[model samples]
Target: MLLAKVIGSVVSTQKSPSLTGKKLLLIQWVNADGSLPAQDQIRTEIAVDSVGAGEGEIVLVTCGSSARRVFPEPNDAIDMAVVGIVDSVSQNLSA
Candidate 1:
């Protein structure tokens, strides 16, 4: 799983049959501090959301083998999905 922030949304009128109702989104990978890296510093990616995540929301994204767990019937084409919305995050440096 990776941490990402929803930067924007995707509107598609035409798509593959397997993606008929899935919501597409523009997500930007964030650093541990929850800040988006510079364009030259990191690659941005998109994910399909079945769970209604909006822009500016911090989200948890599952990919590859683990991504399938988000949806029981995830087709072969579904590579990513937004699994959860994070309300607050805190890191412990003393651990």
Candidate 2:
């Protein structure tokens, strides 16, 4: 899983049957410290919203095969999915 911010939404008139009713969101990758990446290094992707995450909200993204498991149809053609909305994140700086 990775942390990201929902930047915008995607609307497609035609989509695969499995993705017909899913909400697609544009998300930008976020650093573990909660800072966004440099402008040049910014990476954005489209993810299926499984948790009803809204734009500007911090969300948890699951990628690869694991992303498909969240839907009722496990074979859904999804490479990424928003699994959770983040309220806060904590990490130990010292190792």
Q: Which candidate comes out best when scored by TM-score? A: 2
- Candidates' RMSD to native: 1.9, 1.4
- lDDT per residue, candidate 1, 1-95, as tens digits? 78899988778777767667777889988876789778787757878885789999889999886665566563556788898888877889897
State the lDDT of candidate 2 residue by residue for 19-40, as single tens digits. 8888999999998777898999
How far is 6's C-alpha from truth in model 1 (Å)?
0.4
Query: Considering every candidate listed, which one attains the maximal lDDT?
Result: 2
Off by over 4 Å in 1: 72-74
Q: What is the C-alpha lDDT of each candidate?
A: 0.80, 0.91
Residue 75 in candidate 2, Cα distance off native in Å: 4.6
**CA error at residue 54 for candidate 1, angstroms:** 0.4
